[model samples]
Target: MEKTVMIDGKQVQFKSNGATPLKYKMQFRKDFFAEILKLHKLGKLKNLDEIDDDVLGTLDFEVFYNIAWTFAKTADSSLPDPETWLESFNEFPIFDFISELQEMIMANIQSKKK
Candidate 1:
């Protein structure tokens, strides 16, 4: 499944292949968890003992940037590297884009469950 949303005033399409390779999926999860752990170590995230989805969703721009860049790279290789791509933006709509992408991912998962 694929959907396009505006990010930094540019149209960016996020693609999800139901058949995504396990390696990429694993890497995404690994990196995500690592970021969370790093944040906890830095005392950036509250409740070190347990983090709920609500807390995860409230992560700052750094985490959002990493996830978004990873997702974008998986979706499109033709795009520039994360640093270059990020540099292109004067202001990033991180939360808005993440929300849209998250919805798209959930919708894709739901479709596949059938």
Candidate 2:
């Protein structure tokens, strides 16, 4: 799946290549589960209706950065690193972009389950 969002007055593109590779999955497992546990414990993710804007606002950028870097195929290929790439944006809609990414991943998982 693919999505385009305006960031820093530029149209940034993001894509999800279905299920992530096992290697990347394993690499991010601890951090992924940690975030999930943290959100659940904070009652920000117990259910769709329970998501709190305050809690979501506190989420770190690591998870989003990892996912974005793993899937980003920007036109400029000389960004040095993900951090630099992300930093290039003057105003990044982190929350909105991450939400879209999560939905893509969840949808992919659900489709495979059926």
Candidate 3:
């Protein structure tokens, strides 16, 4: 899956594919699926408002940045290291777009049942 989202007034590209998890593991040194499981509740919520404060409080928020950067890096190889790339942006509203990123992640892992 591929998408372009606006961040800090710039259009940034992101992609998720078979290699995305490998790339994430290489870059972040953490298992992609494990990190994703941390946010599993978000996957089931219909909206941010549906998230309980207790659940939100328990989430490892850094995973959001890691996953976002991984997808961004996968889409554009020339993007600098994650921190530097993120520094270039004045703001990155990960919450505003995490659902989209999660969809891409889920698509890469889910299989169709027939």
TM-score winner: 3
Clash pairs detected, candidate 2: none
Task: Give the better candidate number (2 or 3) by lDDT.
Answer: 3
TM-score of each: 0.55, 0.56, 0.87
Error of 3 at 38 (Å): 0.7
Tens-digit per-residue lDDT, 1-114, candidate 2: 777767678777666553443423654565433443333323224444565687667766566566565556433334456667778887776544556566554544444544
Error of 2 at 12 (Å): 1.2
Order of the predicted models by lDDT, top scorer first: 3, 1, 2
Q: Write the per-residue lDDT of candidate 3 for residues 1-114, one digit (tens) a residue.
A: 899888889999999888999999998899998888887876666666777988888778788788888999999999999889989988887667776777798886678987
What 10-residue stretch in candidate 2 is worst by lDDT? Answer: 36-45
Question: What TM-score quantifies how close candidate 1 is to the native fold?
Answer: 0.55
- Model 1 spans > 4 angstroms off: 18-60, 107-114
The residue-by-residue lDDT of candidate 1 on 1-114, one tens digit each, is: 676778778887666564333423464455444454433322333234454667666655565566566566667878776688789888885545555666544443344443
